[model samples]
Target: MRTAATILDFQHVTKKFGKTIAVNDVTFQVKEGEVYGLLGPNGAGKTTVIKSIVGHLRPSSGSITISSYDLQKEFADAIDFVGAVVEYPMHYEYMSGYQNLKLTANMYPEVTKARIEEVIELVGLQGRIDEPVRKYSLGMRQRLALAQSILNYPQLLILDEPMNGLDPLGMRDLRNLLRSLAANGMSILVSSHILEEMELMCDRIGIMSHGYMIAERNMDEIHHAQTPVYLVRVNDPEEALKLLSEEYGEQLHAKEAVGGRIEVETTLISASQINRILIKAGIEVQEIHEKKQSLEELYLQLTGGAEIE
Candidate 1:
């Protein structure tokens, strides 16, 4: 498989606030044309990382490079290829959304009128594009802020809680829009407290806890690496349970069968092996399937069962 180019690189990055360490010796990279998520609970240093990337706060000790330009050394040039929405939407409440975008475009000499219109449509803000920002709903304002961020057609986009104020339909629309942008080669790094949404939206996720990065893995890796558990259906629940218990010993975890179905928790055994054993023992097999672990389950396990702050 061909490797994607690295668009954002954070090498041994650390951020400190006096006696408090916000981010500690963290290292990660975001590749081109992929949606990367920083998944963490509140106070997990996610916002600090986002702020450092956008040049709002400098890392105490580390190197940050965006599109091959060192952020500290070449702030202007590096930021030219980057755009971000650090937190809540900030806009001129009295100005129309269209005017807000137009003013933002004026800051970039290359931003055109057509590009402004295109982003408004892309973010589904065309209906309220002419309305004053103060009159817009929270979700609409968020969308407008997103549109402004992309007005310059950045190579890298960093969003801090991009889905914060969106409704269900609004979240769905944002997901689709982000997918389209990534398909067109825009690298994205987004932070979110919503686990399920991150599971669906991100190509890969980095889990952070308390100020440290605990793990980073793609969805498939998370799914396959968790201890395998399955729900099984058989003719003789007692026999299957007894046989499985005997064969696997302590590795077997048999739950009470409900309606002739049994739940087994084991990592060393596969569905096929379970089925074969039951059939060989004259236990009729009605249905058998593997139960995939939810992202929440894996996340809990990785974080030592600590509640998300």
Candidate 2:
């Protein structure tokens, strides 16, 4: 893709706070109309990476580009099409929600009051639009934060822990809202501890750990796994087990039926050879398919069983 075609790109980007490398030489690309998830445990360089991309923190080395604007050389132009909420993104507590949105809009040269009201309504805060932000709940604040971010109709929206303090209903609404925004050609980078939500919301996901991008995958790659597992389903499992023991017992794993199917994880065996062996033993292979692992399982396997932080 040309530089302008890519909404965001981090090439060998590294960020350091003193001697601590918060974000290592990370590289990733986000295309337009895609919600790219930056998922990781706490202290996994997630926040640092987001901060670097959105102009809060500069990378110590390497490069980050937003469309045709180089982050280092064209900071203002790079940020021109970007709008974000870095953290809690608190507005004036004493001000009404409408007032807060108005002030935010006023920061832009040509932003009008009507545009402010439009964004507030879009975020579903219209009923309480005149209420003070201090009285707003966590979910309300999040909604307002989103409203502020979209006031510019940003080409790239970077939200850090956007679902931080939202209820289930709010999270669901936010997911739908983000999907709609992406459909409108806005690229988004959302970093949140909500892995399940990310799994549902994002078109692609990148896992970060120990200041490095551990994995990046599209929906299909993230969801459907091609793990080298053999799922053995047979009419006579006892006979089938015995036949397997007589032949390839060493590669066998957890020889038990679960959910009406016998599962085995092994060093990828050939489907034709398995069929031939089963036919020769007269084991009546009802269904013998490869078992694919889920994203959650793959995550645990790769991350040394670390908990989401």
| TM values, all candidates | 0.80, 0.80
Residues 168-250 of candidate 1 have per-residue lDDT tens digits of 99999999998889999999999998998898888899998878888888977765666676889887888888888888778
TM-score quality measure for candidate 2? 0.80
- Please give, for residues 162-236, the per-residue lDDT of candidate 2 as tens digits: 898888888888999999999999999999766788999999988887898988878777566555777877777
Q: Which residue pairs overlap in candidate 2's backbone?
A: 42-309
Q: How much is 290 displaced in model 1, in angstroms?
A: 7.4
For each candidate, the alpha-carbon lDDT, in order, equals 0.88, 0.84
The C-alpha local distance difference test score for the whole of candidate 2 amounts to 0.84
Clashing residue pairs for model 1: none
RMSD of each: 6.3, 6.4
Off by over 4 Å in 2: 1-4, 224-228, 231-290
